[model samples]
Target: MINQDFLSRIRRKNNWTQEDMAKIIGVSRPTFIALEKGIGSPTLDQIKKLADKLGCESQDILSEDIVDEEKYREVLLETIRYGAATDGKITKTKLAKLIYLNDFAWYYQHLESMTGAKYRRLKLGPVPNIYFSKVEELINEGVLNLEIKKDGSQMISLSRAGQMLKPNLLKTEEKKLIKNISQKWQGKRTEEIVKFTHEQLPYKICRDGEVIPYELITQQDPEYVY
Candidate 1:
């Protein structure tokens, strides 16, 4: 059975009218309305097309409901562990940019986000707001050990305190994408990564505190032409 509420949310989130969504998904307006109203069902092929057009996973479209919080926490922790393994530790800012790159770059290449974490345009660039709470949860759970020290500035380092996260949690493509992103940013200073992210179209166009839309990744930027 098709998930009408999820479909409706996806369409509205993209700012598409019912007729517009119907046309894009190759359905008549009435058919689309029926689906949205839970009076009709979407065939498997239509579900595939909807996922493709919406830039989401098929399960995301077909699943009975959205439980984003738990999934978000798992992805964020796994990604942090992956990044922390590369270097002794990853700075908070660099980790934030890495997360942003993984999401936006995946969107640029596949029109989908690996974790689908919401990001806000901040002075440091795009920052995933949920990471702070996730980190706290991990610390409480003893999955990570945090070290705070002062040099010229405050410094924080995260080290694994438990066994490595199981590999099965993320899809193969998602694991590969996160690893690729971590390797790409490895050895780069936090400032350099921040500068690079500041150049991305999403970060450039969104005002401070504004939510960066995944759709913005499809836009052509003069600085970084696709």
Candidate 2:
């Protein structure tokens, strides 16, 4: 079941009013209130939409289950491997970009549900500074590394310590996560496979049974889970 308290916390973190969120998600103010208050459970479709809008995975909202420190380290190692495989090194900026981009795709899909309004068109923009702050925290903890150049663009990469831990990150866990996502979005305009790259995570939008990767599917507000 979805955690209403978790939803409330995320809402407050974003400084969004219930009405504001209701408008974005295409729900009535009263319905949104009911949802936040734990008076009802949202439909599967509604949950899917909500997951996207909040820039979080469904697992993040589903229960109080928390990933322990061991699991956290494992996932971070996998992320480093995936990121570095595309390039020799994983930078902080790259990590931030990947996390934010994925979140944006999730949120954009659920925008109408969150705001309770007609889904407006979204423009891909630069990542916000708050994301950088989160990235910095990770860097300070030795999870990632930042190489700043004179040109002002920093090459953010994962640390060597992070790289060594990748194999311990269970592939079975990742496969299950992707499988759940696929089932949740079955037969929708959304694609079955979401590929994350060094540059962007492609959100393939289907048109007439044909998959087309749209640039509009870029990430917006980014948060690092670990």
Estimated TM-score for each candidate: 0.64, 0.36
Tens digit of per-residue lDDT, candidate 2, span 30-146 = 998888787886676665676788678766556322222243334334444454423445444344434333333433543211111111111222233344444566678887777
lDDT of each: 0.68, 0.45
Considering every candidate listed, which one attains the maximal TM-score? 1
RMSD for each model, in Å, please? 9.8, 13.6
Q: Tell me the lDDT of candidate 1.
A: 0.68
lDDT of 1 by residue, 50-142 (tens): 788868877766642232455555556555666653446767777777777776777677765655567888998887767777767777887
Of candidate 2, the 10-residue stretch with the lowest lDDT total is 112-121
Candidate 2: lDDT of 10? Answer: 52
